[model samples]
Every structure is written in C-alpha cells, then in structure tokens.
Target: MLYFEQLLVNGLMLGAVYALAAVAYTLVYGVVKLVNFAFGELFMLGAFITLSLMAPEISLLGHVVPMPGLSFHAAAPLAIAAVAALGALIDRVAYRPLRNAPRLAPLITSIAVSVLLQSLAQTVWGPGSLRFPDTPLSQIPAVHLGQVSISGSNLVVICAALVAMAGLQCFVRFSSLGRAMRAAAQDTTAACLVGIPVNRIIGLAFVLGSGCAAIAGILYAQAFEFASPTMGFTPGLKALTAAVLGGIGSVPGAAVGGLFLGIAESLCAGFLPNGAVYQDALSFILLVLLLLVRPQGILGKKEMNSHARGSLITAKARKRASMVTAPLRAMDRLFASRFFDSWTFRLLVLACSIAAGLLVQSDYWLSIMIVVLVYGMLASGLNIVVGFAGLLDLGFVAFWAVGSYFTSIVFIDVLQKQFGIDVDSVWWLLYANLILGGALAAVCGAILGYPTLRVRGDYLAIMTLGFGEIIRVVATNWVSLTNGPMGIRGIPSPSLFGYEIGDSRSLYFFALALTVVLLFCIGRVVRSFVGRAWVALREDEDAAQAMGVPGTRYKLLAYACSGFVGGVVGVFYAHFQQYISPASFSLFENILILMLIVLGGLGTMIGPFIGAAIWIVFLQLSLKVPFVNSYPESRYILLGAMLIALMLFRPSGVAAKARLRLVMEGV
Candidate 1:
C-alpha cells in the first residue's frame, strides 16, 4: 500500500511535466492545424539553452566556450524566452511557406526541422549526458506525508506546471489574442475575412506553446539532474499522445489526459513483471487504440477533425504540376511517353543493372549497390502509400522489420534450433518464407490502414508513427522472441537451384532481379484501375468517393501492396546482412526512405530509384571529405536544409509533372 502511494506521487510528478509539454502541442496544433513534430526538438533545445546559461564553461561545437552561469531562476526565463522566439521563427520559416501547400509538405518540413535541431543539439552538446548543477530548487529537502514522500524537485515540477496551466487557461479564455486564435482554429479563411490577424495569432500560439514546453524541459532536467540531446523524443511523443487523448484544443483536458497516462503507466510498471520494459511503448499503443475509437478525443469538438478528408495531400495535381520548371517539365514529358512506360525500357534498365553487377568486381562497391537496390525498393513501396494514396505513413519500416524478423526466426530459431534441421538442405524454405513473410506484413499493413479510414493528416501520421514505435519497442524488449540487444545472427544465405548466393556480386544480381520484378509488378498495377483510383484519392479523396471509386478499399489495398514490397525487401536484407536487430530498422530508415521518394519525385514510378541513387551515392561520396566524416551528425543538418529549400522553392520535387497514362501505366 505504501509502495502504491509512492507510485501515485511519482506518477503525479511525471504527469505534471507531461501536461506542461502537452499544452505546447495543443496550442500550436489548434490554431495552425499542424502537429509540429519539431516541438520535441524545441523542448530539447530548452534544456540545452538552460544548461548553456547556467554553466560557467562548456564544450560547444567541439570547442570549450564560456557561459553566462546565471542562477536557475534567472536563466530559465531567458531560456524560455529564447526558445519561444525560436518556435515562432520556425513557424515563419519552415511552415508558413507551405501554408497553402499540401498538409504533408508542412508535416514533413516539421520533421526536417526536428532532425536539424536534434543533430545540431548533438553537435553542440557532444552527444554525451551533461550533469545539471544542484540549484537552490534541487537543494531543498523532501516533503513527507505519512508513508509517502515527495522530493523538492517533484513539488516544484507539480506546482509550476499546474500554475502554468492555470495561467494559460486564463490567458486563452480572456485575452483578445486568444479569441482571435480560437477564430483562426475554427476557420482560417473566415478569421482572416473577419479582420483577425491569423498569422500573428498562429505565431503567438507557437510562442506560448514553446514557453510551456521549455518549462517542462526545465522541470524534467531538475528531476533527472542531467540533460541530453535525445531526452525529448519519448517525452514529446507521450505529450503529443496526451494532447490527443484529452482534447487537442482543450487546455484543462491536456492536464487530465497527462495525469491519466502517467498514472496508468506507473501502475502498470509497478504490477506487471515486464511492464518497465514496455513502458515506452505504452503511450503509442494507447494512441493507436484511442485514434481508432475516438479520434476527436474526450474533450475535443467535431470541428477539430475538419482536416479529415481521407487524404494527407490536400492539393490538386494539375495545380501542383503547373509549378514545375521548364527543364523539369520537359523531363517529365520525356518520361511520360509510351516508350518510358513500356517493358522495353524496363528491360533495358534491368540489363544495365546486370552489366553493372558483372562489371563491378569490388565487394565494397557491390555492397553499396545492393544497399541502393534495397532502398530503391523501399522508396517505391513508400511512394505507393504517400504518393499514390496520399497518406502520410511514418511507420513503413515496421513492415520491413516484420519480414526480416519472421524469416530470421523461422530459419534460425524454429527450423534449425527447434527441430535440429539443416537450413541449407531446405533452401526452398527461403523462397517460401519470402511469400509468407510478405503476406504477413501485408496483413499488418492493412490493419494499420484502419486508422486512415477515420484519422487524417497529422493525426494519421501520429498513428502510423505510433505503430512504428510500438514495433521497435517490442522488438527491443521481447528478449524471448527477438533475442533482445544481442540480436539474431548466423542466418543462412539465399540460394537458387543448386547455386549459392554467397558473394556480394551474386547478391547484387539477386537484388537487381528483385528490383526489376518489383518495378514491373508496380507498373502493371499503376496502369490499371487501381492506379487511377489511387490518383483520384491523392488529388481529392472526397471527390473520388463521390465518383464511386471506393476510397476505403483502394486505400487499404495500397497499404497491403506497399507492405508486400517492403516485406520482400526485408527478406532479402536479412539474408544479405546475415543478421537482424531492432537497430537495423530505426525511424531514421523510414525517414530516409521518405526522403528518397521526396527527392526523386512523388507519384512517379522511376522517382524512387532516382532518389535512392542520389542519396546513397551522396552518402558514399561524403565519406571522402574529412570534415563530413568527422562530424557525422552535420549530414542531418544538410538534409534538413535541403528539405526546407525544396519545400519552399520546389514542393513538386526534382522529377515532377507526373502524367497519368490512360493505357498501360505511369503516374
């Protein structure tokens, strides 16, 4: 019973900080209709800024730098102010330009901003945990009530968060700007027509949200006595989930949701034997279920789901196509011809791939090509979801991971270890598992597709992201099934009829064959009615539904097909790498695949291959540069910058102006 009370106190303390962060998410999302994925990085920056202000000297960008060394009270406010300003600037730079663009444009831009911020923080802070100084707040004694005790830091966290929530509630309720924000949230065009400064109101919301997130970061730093660049990831995700659970736009509801989540997690951890291992996944699991059941949330109004139009891409194809440059327009036209869509061109590409594989004798270069081939497939699969279907799926790698793990466990753990059978003798099982694994992954993808029926835009993105994280968490913790951090090893190599694919050259050939097959299969489908339906959904889902295109069925089918491709790629990757681990399928891989499709071109068959080649080749070439090799995180900054630039100037990407073929296919 005493232990229960302690858990309750701890939960409350945790919930307070989470609620504080949730206010930031709710504030920004309510007014601007964007879930700022970079809000986590903003929260991260708050702690770093506070650390910089309080410390006398610190290592910044690999140099020892002098600091303000201010007291906590003085430094925190300044840090909050700095972060709040940054939050507004982010809105102006990363999002405002994409205001009229597709919703995916802004959402992806936010992720880029997040990547940039995290990488920058890691570079500045040296990727190591920095010890937080023992401030006056930390030095205070604990407060005891009967059998339960609460520390001074916990008290500070609770009181400060509650106070901030109250102050924000009052500000939103009574202030003129708050009324303007509410109006903007209700209808941006209407608010602007009514003479409301919609842009300024949006900026104010970001500022307030950032300030609150900073407060939460400070409170978190105090409680933990340490700061790190990656601290905000899980907390930010949980806070966003809390905001969704309560009411996206309701201030008090954020608090209630946070408390509920914190208490549930704490209790689960206390009672369940392996709950602690699964705690990080709890919020995501809850998020998926909640999105399925009540997407508007407990306190949210129906108007909160105004953007649920069945498609994340909210722009007309012709309008977007018209913005392409003259040169790119010519390229698009050249690629739109019957020759480009024909099997002859595809066969020529396949022949070229075979020639390259045979010519490249070096193992290292062949391995790189193999990676490019796999990633190309990943990009292609993702394009079907994000480009053709117009859904923002952040969890595509989960399917890939599913395929990799299934084949590995079956070949190694089940067939060999359990039955003591030789895997090489039953090489046919490999081919069989490829089909079975892909089918299983397709089923999973369709299950994930359910949220697309109800959730849209950023909400849909979060649900997909949650699914991805849940898979990662389970893979990392379920030692019995996944072998935990040690990972699965010694998987048998793939083989053909009486031939072995043991070398990199053979693997390259094998991978190239798979890539060509995938492209051919994709081409066949995209030229059919399914492809037309996807295009219709991408351009305008409601209109497609009205046209009897069966938006629900086609959307779900896209996910299944995409998953099948990802699964096939995963199966090959497991054998090629000869090992599998949770780390192999990180969120970065998903982002990288998305980047490939974005950089190449959306809604185009060959775009994924082009993007993969450019990105993977750039990565390889970067190794030759000493500075880039040393400062690895700097690459992400470049990536983020590129995404921002592309969004601002060329949201259509490098290979744009995709023309739909009424006959044998191209999108």
Candidate 2:
C-alpha cells in the first residue's frame, strides 16, 4: 500500500509536467499542423538556461565565468520568456518561409531545427549531463497525507500546471486573440479571409507553446535535480505521445492523455520486470500502437484530421520557390547534357579517381575517401526507399546496424569465442556473411515495412522513427547479447583470399571496388521495370495501384533491396573498422544519410555519390577551424543549418533534372 501510494504521488508529479508539455505540442500542432521537433530542444534550452541563471558561476568554452546566482523564482520566468522568444524566432526563421512549400520541405526543416538546437545546447553547456546546483525548491520537505508522501516540489509543479491549463482554457473561451487562434486553427484561409492576422496568431502559438514547454522543463528539472542536452528528447517524445493519446488540437484531451500516460509509465516502472531498463522504449511502443489503432486520438474529431499529404503551396510561394530553385535547375540541365554521359566525362572521372587513390599517399585522405564511399552506399540505399519508392524511412540505419551485428556475432562471438575456432583459418566465411547479412537485413526491412508502411508519409515517418529508437534501445539494454555499450571490439578486416586487406590503401581500394559495383548495380536496378514500379509509387501510389501495380508487394521489395544494400555496407563497415559499436549507428546517422540523398538530388543516380563526397569532404575540411575543433559539437549545428538552408533554397536538390523515360500508354 505504501509503495503504491508513493508511486501514485510520483506519477501525479510526472503527469503534471507531461500535461504541461503536451499543451505545448497541442497548441503548435493545432495551428501549424507540423510536429515541431524543436519543442524538445526548446524544453532542453529552458532547463539549461534556468539552471545557468540560478547558478553562482558557469563554464563557457572551458572558461569559468561569474554568475548572478538568482533564485529559481526569479530565473525561471526570465528563462521562459527567453525560450518563448526563441521559439517564435525559430518558427519565423525556419518554418514560416517553407509553410506554403511541399509537405516534406517544412517537415525536413523542423527536424533540422531540432538537430540544430540540440547541437547548439550541447556546444554551449558541454556534452556531459549536468547535475543542477542545490536549490530551495529541490530541498523542500515532503508532506505526508495518510500513507502517501508528496514532496513540496511536486506539489508546486502540479498546482502551477493546473493554473496554466485553466488560464489557457479561459483565454481561449473569452479572449479576442485566443478566439482568433481557434478560428485560424479551424480554417486558416477562412480566418485570413475574415481579416484575422494568421501569421501573428501562428507566432503567438509558438510563444505560448514554448513558454508552456519551458515551465514543464524547469519543473521537471527541479524534480530530478539535473539538466542535459539529451534530457528533453524523451520527455518531448512522451509529451507528443500524450498529445496524440488525448487528441491533438484538444487541450482538455491533452491533459487527460498526459495524466493517463504518466500514471501508466509510473505503474509499469514499479510492476514490470526490467521496466526501468525499457521504460523509455514503452512510449515509442505505445505511440506506434496508438497510431495504428487510432491516429485521430481519443478527443480529436474525425474532421480535424490534418495530416496533409499534398503540397500546401500557394501561387506566390510557388513563384518564390521556383526562383530559389532556378540555379539548381540550371545545374540539372548541365548534368542532363550529352557531355555528362559521354565516354570522355566517364574516362575523366575514372582517371581522376584512380590518380587520387594512387597519388594521395597519406592514410587520412584514403580513409576519408573510404568513408565517403561507405556513406554513398548508405545514402544510395536510402534513396531507393525515399527517392524511388516514395517512402520516407527515418530508420534506415537499423538495417545497417543489424547486418553489422549479424556478422560480428557470427565471426567473433559464435565462431572465435564460443566454438574455440580460429577465425583466420575460416576467412572465407566473411564473403558469405556479406550475402547472408544482407539477406537478414532484407527480411527485417520487409517485416518492418509490412506492418508500418501502410500509413501516410508522416505517420510512416513516425513509425520508422519509433522502429529506429526501438532497435537502438534494444542494442543498449540487451547487455548479454550486445555487451551493453562497452561494444564488441577487434573484428578482423576483410581478407581477400590469402592477403589481408588491412592497410588504409588496401581497404580504400577494396571499399572503392565494392562501392562502384553496388552503385552500378543500383543504376541497373533503377532502370529496370522494378525501378519503374518504385518510381511510379514515388510519384503517386493511388494512380499506380489503379494502373495494376501491387503497392504493398513493390514497397516491400524496395525495403528488401534497400536493406540488402545497407546490410552489405554494414558488413564492409564492420570489417573496415575492425570493431563494432552502437555509436557508429545512431538516429543521427539516418538523418545524415537522408541529408545526403536530399543534397545530391532525390531520384538521381549520381546524386547520392555527389552528396556523399560533398558531405564527407566538407565535414573533414570544417575541422580546419580552430573554434570548431575546440567545440566539436558545433559541427552538427552547422550541418543542421545547412540542411535547413538546402530545404529552403533547393527543395528539388542539386540534381533537379533526371533522364526519365516516358511510359507507353496501356503498357
């Protein structure tokens, strides 16, 4: 009874914070219809800034600076205000311009903003999770009510949350601006026609949502007595789940969903075996199930469903977008010219590649080339799903991880360690594992695609994101199999027949051969009828299905093919590094690969290779900056900002033109 009471009290406190954050999500989602991934980063910023304000001194770029040492009451409001302004600024800078563009333009930009903010936070506050300095709120005594004991901090959090929600409700019901927001939410065009300042209202939504998220973040941090760059991601994800559970665009539903989700999580933590280890994963599982069963959510009206799959472009915006992409279109024409496909260009490229490989005696440059080719393969595989099949898979790296793990386990763990067999003698198995590992990844991809890819792009993206997180979580928690973060080390490099492909130059050559062969095969595959089917799906699924294309089968086949390529790359990656770890395969890697595809040009054969070269080369070159070298975290910030800029300026990418063949009617 005591345990239950304590858990219940704890649950209430968590629920309150979640409810507050859910309000933030619901507010912005109501107006923008975008999953502002940056909300999590805003939440992160709120906590860090509040703590910084309260601290006596803080470190900046390895320098300790004196601080004001203000109290929580004084610092929190300031932090909230600052975060609110930042949230509005972000919406203005990153989202507003792309609002009328294609659905993917803003969606991709939102993720970019999310990554940018997280990296900025990490750079400012350092990468480590920080313990908050002791405060009066954190030191507050627990008050006992019968069997249940509630801390004063928890009580404060709960009371403040209720007041915020109540005030918000009253504002929406009575206030002019609030009413305008509601009207805008219902019908933006109608509100605009009726003389409401839609942009102003949208900005206001960002401010309120940011402020609410800040309040939740600060209170949550006060409870835990810690702040971290990564702290907001889980809470933000959970809040999103809560928002979905209650019904997006419904404040009351958000509150109910948050409370229910918190209590469920708390109870699960207490009752379920190994629950603590898997606690973070539970929300993802719930989200997937909820999306599958009832995406509209409990309180969300059927008519309120606003997952717009089509372009939201207006006439003026289209003109602006076209103007921005004119340069890319020109570049596209350059690539489409006869000179590009001529033998002279091909020979020049081949000669240059060979000369560079031979002349660049330094291992570092060779290693860089190898990395570029590896990522090119990854980006190429992802292009199959996203560019060709028209499925935005945010979790493509999972297949890479799976294949790497499969070979590592088979060669090192199963063969060398367990069976007491010498791995060197059985080097031939590595070649076979490439095919087997790819096959394994193909199966996994098909399985994942079958259940999850039935939804629209946004939902499919969410599902894939969840799938990626699950794989990561499993790799992290499953200690016995995975060795749990310590990682598997000392896997052998690729041995070609008798000679080991161990040197940087040897590995470079080997990787180059594999990359060229894979890309060539991909080129061949994309020109085939299978590729045509995939492209048709990419263009319009319904039209293709109407034209006798098997949407499900073809989509699954794409997943399999892409997975096979990723798995093959994974085998190479494992061998190349001579070590395997979860660190190499992260959520960010997926974004990087996706960015490569976007950078090179979606649906272009040469785009992935070009993107890979540019990304890897520039990433390596950026290290020349002393500031970047000192603050390594800022690289991600730069990359994210570049992604945003790319989405804004070159929505179609560098290779905007393609050698598309006309399909014969009735064929």
What would the per-residue lDDT of candidate 2 be over residues 75-135, giving only the tens digit for each residue? 9999999999999998898888877765666767878898898989888889898887666
As a whole number from 0 to 100, the lDDT of residue 92 in candidate 1 is 87
The TM-score between candidate 1 and the true structure equals 0.94
- Report backbone clashes per prediction: 0, 0
**Candidate 1 least-lDDT 10 residues:** 658-667
Query: What does candidate 1's lDDT look like per residue over 363-482, in tens digits?
Result: 999999999899989999999999888888889999999999999999989988999998888888888888898899999999888776798666777788888988998999989999
Deviation (Å) of 430 in candidate 1: 1.3
Q: Which candidate comes out best when scored by lDDT?
A: 1
TM-score of each: 0.94, 0.92
Instruction: Show the colliding residue pairs in model 1.
Output: none
RMSD of each: 2.7, 3.1
Number of the predicted model whose TM-score against the real structure is largest: 1
lDDT of 2: 0.83
